[model samples]
Target: MAGEVGKPNGSGGLGFKGSQIPHIKFTKLFINGEFVDAVRGRTFETIDPRTGEVIAMIAEGDKEDVDLAVKAAREAFDHGRWPRMSGYERSRILMKFADLIDENIEELAALDTVDAGKLFSWGKTVDIPHGAALLRYYAGAADKIHGEVLKMSGEYQGITLLEPIGVVGAIIPWNFPTNILFMKLAPALAAGCTIIIKPAEQTPLSALFYANLAKQAGIPDGVVNVITGYGPTAGAAICSHMDIDSVSFTGSTEVGRLVMQAAAASNLKTVSLELGGKSPIIIFNDADVDKAAELALLGVVHNKGEICVASSRVFVQEGIYEELEKKLVEKAKAWTVGDPFDPTTNHGPQVDKKQFEKILSYIEHGKVEGATLLTGGKPVGTKGYYIQPTIFADVKDDMTIARDEIFGPVMALMKFKTVEEAIQRANSTRYGLAAGIVTKDLNIANTVSRSIRAGIIWINCYFAFDSDCPYGGYKGSGFGRDLGLDALHKYLQVKSVVTPIYNSPWL
Candidate 1:
């Protein structure tokens, strides 16, 4: 990394002031490898979540801008050099993109920290590097994409060839903006597909910054485009666009439905959705009390509880329920909530005012529905959208907080008497995105993990994501995987060719 920026961990509670932060440089629609204004010359304010103030004026792209982006992407896919170029050549460009990310990690990290209110250290340590590594991971797969050969019964030969699926439209979520962008973009690029990204309106800074980096890395014109606007306009446009071959979306389950419906209502384009979750962390009596509490609390508190797969519904075994609650209070106290740029701050504010209010309302619902407020359930400060890490005890399965996807750091701690009861309660919700089990017993681990109908399960750990691990959801959480080789395959289409032998009867 060239720029050694960002403050180190210390005892200071204060952070870099708004004036001290890096200036917002890129805030326009990125299409055809150029920074251009929206078609109508309209713009919207991208707010700084930490202060609930406008950070910069970003281009507000609607249907017309999406159309322009799609047109550029279509031309790139049908006639441009990106799709026609050799996989190795494409891989070179992607590798260079990753390299440039490393070179300007400071500016990129600052952009996400200010735009999305993500912890700056987390951006530097995890978000930026992981996203870059995702690029490299997909880069390694670029040249290796291939098909299979088949033998026919009667003097014939058959072979299947894998090819790019053409233009892809990706709708990204506000949380984890950088990571999700690369998660969608890396695989699409590796598969030789031109992509039009509709980043969540709240956090367009990093995506726009990434677009500039993509162009600098020598990614061909029109191969990667970003439209920064709201879902109803830009996102819906991408989903319903006739020319788009496929759409990959990550957000709430309700929005995922809209994306699917639009795709079906339009050209029936392929849609892959990684949607919301009310994931559970089941704690067995055999587990370490502190470790289980840490896992459960961190799972909810990380990213200010803005993540989809937050283990918000925790089912603790009756034997260790009280002890784990005490431990959770201790750990959450130390998990300070403050400005993103503060190195001492482990958690930051919600993505925007809307999300912060939504989380607070859910916390109130937990109380109204008779769930015990174990600890930390109020706003941290007056100015920013910060909420305390709250844990609700004696939470019923039927409670509003337990039932709904409260995408915040509010844990619904419920007690279960038996292993069968634990499994049954954990699988009760409509979401099946992810689940975590903290147990030393091997039999219990195997039994409950296999029984729960979730896409991914963690044993004694949470948020254990890697570039190689396939992450997605089942049931109402929506279908399709994000990372791993499966993501790469989603952007590719398979075609089989058959031929008869010269002296065969078939000819």
Candidate 2:
């Protein structure tokens, strides 16, 4: 709190807005469950995408730092008292951690909004709060991890024991840093696994800040460590570290592949990747145009369309394509794109300048591929890297816009003739993280949901997520589910304990 600094508003006016809130500076790294300076004593500045100005300076962690953190985590997993604690006791501590997160939600949300340019309403009201809820849920789940008593045929008895998998490395993406980090960490922690967290460099402030809160929450030293640096360096180090027992990564498919390769090369660590998605949203003629348009807009345009399952590819029935397109275009235009601090602003700038350029390039590609630009083709505002919410029509299945994960505020609308064709087009992409279908017909909705080869199927809804639900995808979208009791299995190992009742007879 002492190093916090407030940013100026869009008018460059150092007025009430700037005075109300402040930016933050994180100059130390969290390792061994403590805030300490990096051993190498190096640091880097995090730039604000809106102003292209250095907002905060963070501890720059490299391979040496990664090793130190991993060693601490390994020591905790092997020799520390955490793994030896009762499941109930561990659950109590995790509940405490969740309470701490809720207590400091405002501070954490402010930091996230400043660092990542996400909407404060979302970060404060939704992301941080849900993150805490997940932690609490996992906390309650910790003690409830049950083993089985299996019946044996011979003179022997068998039982299965659920045990921790040891040190885990969780690499989270920039878009939803706190939410995703908590999603991975809560279950791993509840399962008695120590962790080394590598947050996206574009938005590392909140992750590091949350580490401080973890210490305050009674989590033991070395139980949770955060290293803030680029993916290729700190992230790669995490993946390849021999001491790490497993790796859980959420990022682009290309980078996800590297993470897997690194894990395989180092120790063949158990890896769970939640990679990219070219999620599709299909709208049928029977669907309500206004409702479909609303869900469609939320699918791609929400969170600046930076979500992995953004529903970048939208499939509309030809009977209602023109009507739906009009509604979608109008709905998109209604969303205000401006500074995240503005309470009324619906869309915010991309994470950084580079991502802004990449999104622009994709829009250009849409134009080149003959996808008629329906609305929003250019960047908005002069100060920040804000892009206008874009939508394209006449898109073919082969178009690059329809095939690739744009990871921006560009929605490519394609028309399909029949329900079968819609299902086929939705599942055509290499990714299958999520999909949405809008229809009033129960049979059509049920059929389409069953046919889509994605992890989550939304009916007349988009961007719906809950801590209790299972999430993750098949194919290029990556493997391993996150959230709910099912996620707990990923961080635990099943061991069969067998005993011979008639040892004398066998001998």
Candidate 3:
């Protein structure tokens, strides 16, 4: 790596001051495994969300660049040697790629934290490792892809084959760029599909870094291309480009809709959207108070609550409502917040000024709606766009904070009397990405897991994840799974072939 960056471990806090971090220039787009300038030579500055200072100047790619990337991917998919390789060979290369990611975990994590304002520990422990593991998981699944022979009434032989879906457009979100990119990219590559990735403008550095790493890993040029620019320009171009075979997007529901619309207008390509969520977490009276409180805080306050499946709404049983509220407030206030480069910081600033203002506005809205502000309703520091971890009490299901997706460190607390009421309130949201239940009773766990409409349910835990498990949601949270063997299947198409055996009695 040409640039050396420092990563945070668990130590001091991530602090911020208003000063420019020297601009790191990145003017080229990665297309056909080579770095080249944009056609129009346009570029934009990427600001550090923590200090509001421009840290990098990135290429501003558009339709022409998108066209170049798609053509390259299509050429690779149609005539390249990648798909012709044996499954075992593909698996070996992917495993090596995963190992390469492990070797650069600290560097990648540092880049992600600086660019996205995600907590250092989050990037190091959760995001980077999981991303590497996802690649390995998909690598293992490469050879496991099975085909079947079928018996036919006629004197013929029948078989089924799984083949790659041509060139793919992977549109990733800003929150967890490196993590989600591999979640989509690894599987697509393992299944023999060529790719064109359009990473979110706010945090495109890490994805570009990985694109370079793909080149080093001997992934043929054009097998994986990454273009960085605004969603309306580069992103929309990728979605609607006729040469692209499919689109996999992870972002807000509104943008996902736009992607779907663009796909319809052009190729009518296969699309998988992993969108927004107004997820919920339920705390039953019988649960362990301390553990529940800790997990509950992590559910929404961790990562500054910038996750798509963040449990923003909390429903506490009436019996332990007051106790849990007190515990939650005390624990939430002490969560260390500052620079992502600081090892001790538990939370970092929101991604940028817009998100910071958005979180503050929601905090104000919560106060105006008559919800009792238990703690933290203002920005914590003067330098960066930092907001105090906020909790709202006496919250009703009808409140905007409870009904809508506020992608911030604001938690809404409501009371529920019975299991039925809890389930009903939990299922009320238009979004159903994930839900958490804290209870000791096995029956309650089973019942709530089945009752909640979310795709992933956590029993006595929150935000638990594994690369081997499928993760996604229902309703407005969007369709399609992103992890596990299922994600690889999304990149494949099934075909049936029939042939005559000996040409005996039938003739």
lDDT of 2 by residue, 310-384 (tens): 988888889998899999999988889988877888988898998999999999999998999989979987877
List lDDT for all candidates, in order. Answer: 0.89, 0.85, 0.85
Ranking by TM-score: 1, 2, 3
Worst 10 residues of 1 by lDDT: 1-10
Clashing pairs for model 1 are: none
For model 3, how does the per-residue alpha-carbon lDDT over 363-404 read when each residue is reduced to its tens digit? Answer: 889899999999888887788788888999989889889988
Ranking 2 against 3 by TM-score, winner: 2
lDDT of 1 by residue, 1-507 (tens): 011112221121123443245666667788887777888888898888888877777788999999999999999999999988889999999999999999988778888887888988888899999999999999999999999988778778999999999999999999989999999999999999999998889988778778888888999889999899989989999999999999999999999999999999999999999999999999999999988988999899989898988999989888988888889888888888888888888888888899889988998898898988978889988888999999898888999999999888899888899999999989998999999999999999999999999999999999999999999999999988999999999999999999878786553
Task: For candidate 2, give the lDDT of residue 25.
Answer: 35
Provide the global lDDT of candidate 3 against the true structure.
0.85
Q: Using Cα atoms with residue i matched to residue i, what is each candidate's TM-score against the true structure?
A: 0.95, 0.95, 0.94
| Candidate 1 steric clashes | 0
> What is the descending lDDT order?
1, 2, 3
Q: Please list the residue runs of candidate 1 whose C-alpha ends up more than 4 Å from where it truly belongs after superposition.
A: 1-19, 502-507
